[model samples]
Target: MFRAIGNEELGRGTLGHSLHMLLAEDPDFPSSTRSAVDELMRQSELDCAVRAIIIAVTSAQNPHDELEHVLRSHPALLESEWMCDIRATLREFGCFSLY
Candidate 1:
């Protein structure tokens, strides 16, 4: 069910941290799964950082629109690439929803 995340839960802290720990502490995780889990963790971290900055500046309790606007406004923004990577990795798992 790793591919079943819905809404913004993936980068909202608890879920992401739990997944990272679950994968990291797993003694039997295969190399590919570990790598994918690692990528998910890295991108989740960056996404959380971006979300924090936006919320700090705009004071938006739920800054989904602001985050989307900023990421879509400029292609050069690193958050866009990070978000895309997160989407791609999750998609590879079959049917994950990040939006």
Candidate 2:
């Protein structure tokens, strides 16, 4: 399923966060499965462009456009460190989605 989702380009309509929410919601999903997704999200190659977006924001012609470009060009962006930091900061304030 991981290979299928990662390799396929079926839903331009699908949101990345929605998939994360789905995984978080699935009570039947194994811990190994969730770990796989999280591990995949942490990979450098998959997340490089998103990091580029956050880094490029000040120089970006349009910050929003650059962020969107990052998302479109690298859909893994949300699951990457950008989102992880967001999650961690939120967790510091006592809000966490993963647990």
Candidate 3:
């Protein structure tokens, strides 16, 4: 999930916090503590996506550079489809073109 987030150049922030809060507040939710942790991880991935646009706008780095930095720094990002898409986009944009 971290991989997808990184590849997608997403950020982790308030949205994640909010989701966690909402879930925690729900009295009807049923799951073990371990399951809750897993759900939070999923929420975090989604939050990263939700934050991606903001992150891109706030950072001075180029899009490709931002994504690569995220992927490199977060080893888990290496495993996501987002990573693949990021690579593809970079190639499309000539960020890593060999021309």
Candidate 4:
């Protein structure tokens, strides 16, 4: 069996949080997509955090809520080695806190 996903459906169905829970048991919706979904979700979170980190690290203005959602959802990201370095660097220069 072959299924073709058109452009509109491709955009609408993948790369974001548009997936529905009911599809979990559907054979057409492969279980292997779980990692893809997690990667996309992490990408979304990373986009927010990276932009916020850039802003906070480069300017006097704090990231404020821009870092909230991602940090809340994936707190471990803060403890990652790179993030620890960023935080440590910022702290040394009296820059902003990412928390």
What is the alpha-carbon RMSD of candidate 2 to the true structure? 13.0
Q: Between candidates 1 and 4, which one is better according to TM-score?
A: 4
Off by over 4 Å in 4: 1-48, 62-74, 96-99
lDDT of residue 32 for candidate 2: 35
TM-score of 4: 0.31
Reference-based TM-score of each model:
0.28, 0.34, 0.37, 0.31
The collision pairs in model 1 are: none
Which candidate do you rate higher for TM-score, 1 or 3? 3
lDDT of 4 by residue, 36-62 (tens): 334534666543343333333433333
C-alpha RMSD (angstroms) for model 4: 14.0
Ranking by lDDT: 2, 3, 1, 4
Greater-TM-score candidate between 2 and 3: 3
The clash count of every prediction, one per candidate, is 0, 0, 1, 0
| Candidate 4: clashing pairs of residues | none
What's the distance in Å from true for residue 87, model 3? Answer: 1.9
Error of 4 at 6 (Å): 29
Clashing pairs in 3: 3-77
Worst 10 residues of 1 by lDDT: 53-62
